[model samples]
Target: MSISHRQTASGRPLRVAPAWVGAATPVAGSPADHHPLPVRDAVWIWSVRRFARLALWALPASAVLYGWFTLGVHVPPGPLPIALLAGWLAAVSLIALAGLLAGSRTRRIALTGLLITLAGATLLLPLAALPEESAAARVALAPGQVHTLVEAACAVSGAGVLLLGWAVFRSKLVNPADGVLLMLAAMTLGAGSYGVKPVPTVGALLLLAAGMGLAWTGGRLLPRA
Candidate 1:
């Protein structure tokens, strides 16, 4: 390294370090300086990942709960059942939200389908909640407008699920088998909507399997904290 000399205010000679030395050290705001990720950004990323994981896990759990309530328990439609159904709906919504993070080719389609499903489920909830002997129940269940509306809601939801399944099949994010299962579930559940016996049970079981597959996919795609 070469040194340089300069005259100071007192007229004494001052020695300066080589140019290479200055170049070797990082300047305060220069391009070569390293900057850490901000705390807020880190926290935001963590929260997002955590939510995605939870949503993936919720898919299977909500399916199982819905199946149990609809098939095994045969619980009467009331406040408790309605509350449980609401919770399941919320979980399903979360699952849909997580689909947005899939980074798949058909993610947009999947999200749209999920949103439609959520809307249909919302419409169905109140009808299902009506007490059996209530005047409102009789009016809704009568072969008329309300009954037709219920059927429409079911069909709409089923169509949405079918679309979601197709998107999943093309996504390549998870095993294609999961998409097939979802399609089957949609079909069975659609049949159940028309008073078909035992079909919805099968659909629910298939949904449970699909959920597990989704959860597995999420675990593989996301990094650990």
Candidate 2:
């Protein structure tokens, strides 16, 4: 006798889905194909990638060293300060160049001019300080003159910081928080240069913060495969 298939009390067929039914279904596409963040320009992003981390770290370290020096702490005098300043300036220059590449034409011009002014001022700093070392120095400038020169350097450098900060913010190349930190650092430093009491300490704190922001931003810009 022929037997019919077994059925449940609900009158449903007692059967399994065929294995071929699953095979016939289309596979879902990979999630990786749709990246949340789109890739930016390789040239501008990667150009600074290798050295950005180093610059980020060194900039903060140098700021700390200089801050201690400014505080008249256990820091040694002479070439140590000069060396730190040189290294700090070099790192800043690299960062500025990266910003310039990613910045608008107006910002590029402003940053470039400020950097040039800073370079010239830095070169003349030692010469400007000579009057303090030797009372009878042949190439001595008046105390007022020396002060003016130093203040000018500080002001110009601060302007460079401001421009770079604005550029980074405007370009949106890094995290928005990073741009805010950069701008704060620049403002603090600029304000401190005006002989404001206790402003230097605030500037030092902001400088450290900006360095951290830079490092974080650099990490975000690293290339992915």
Candidate 3:
């Protein structure tokens, strides 16, 4: 159910390893357990959790604000409407990020949460965007539409990379538990490249390669919980 293991990485671009629990350690109500929180480690984890949430919420909130200001005032599928739509998508992505966050925390709880969250996104995104898309659904967007959506969404991903990269490589905010989630996110980006061209021969292969690379890397470096 866990989307990815939480990483102890401080600051790195991609998850350089797999994430897994090393062993079943002690828990409260067990023989020697007494504390409600791991006072020594819990504080740091809490702060990391908060930062992750803020980072995710930022993109969607901005887009939502922009949408309200621009296209919400008029019919969608127009100039500002297009931009707002992209923003809404960014919000959905942030929700996914939140799932990753949960997965990185309590494992069992995260599994059900991630499933429900992604199930909704997978179903809803296509339905919402199909109206303006091309029959092929490639950059079926009109001239400026693709550019607008692509750029904004990519920007959100880019910011996430920068911030999370810093946390994984430089800061110690991420532990090994979260590495896989990050790598998965990176792979998804590569997959979305298909939206740009939808050239199955090239795009599909690229996405596959990227996803495999992420899987391989995650399996290698992170602990297999």
**Leading candidate by TM-score:** 1
Report, for every candidate in turn, its global Cα lDDT versus the true structure: 0.64, 0.54, 0.39
In model 2, pairs of residues that clash are none
The TM-score measured for candidate 3 stands at 0.29
Local accuracy of candidate 2 as per-residue lDDT tens digits, 156-192: 6667667666666665445557556766776776666
Model 2 RMSD to the real structure? 16.4
Q: What is the TM-score of each candidate against the true structure?
A: 0.67, 0.61, 0.29
**Candidate 1: minimum summed lDDT over ten consecutive residues — where?**
14-23
The per-residue C-alpha lDDT of model 2 at residue 4 equals 28
**Per-residue lDDT value at 61 in model 3:** 45
**Model 1, stretches more than 4 Å misplaced?**
1-43, 72-83, 86-90, 93-102, 132-143, 223-225
Residue pairs in steric clash, candidate 1?
none
TM-score (C-alpha) between model 2 and the true structure: 0.61
lDDT: which is higher, 1 or 3? 1
Which candidate, 2 or 3, would have the higher lDDT against the true structure? 2
Candidate 3: minimum summed lDDT over ten consecutive residues — where? 12-21
lDDT at residue 217 of model 2 (Cα atoms)? 62
lDDT of 1 by residue, 1-225 (tens): 322233434554433221211123347576554433344444555566556756777777778776776655645664466446635854454464434434566767877787888788777766656543452565545534566666787887787787788887887656788888878887777667686667777878988888788678756654312
Deviation in Å, model 3, residue 92 alpha carbon = 6.2
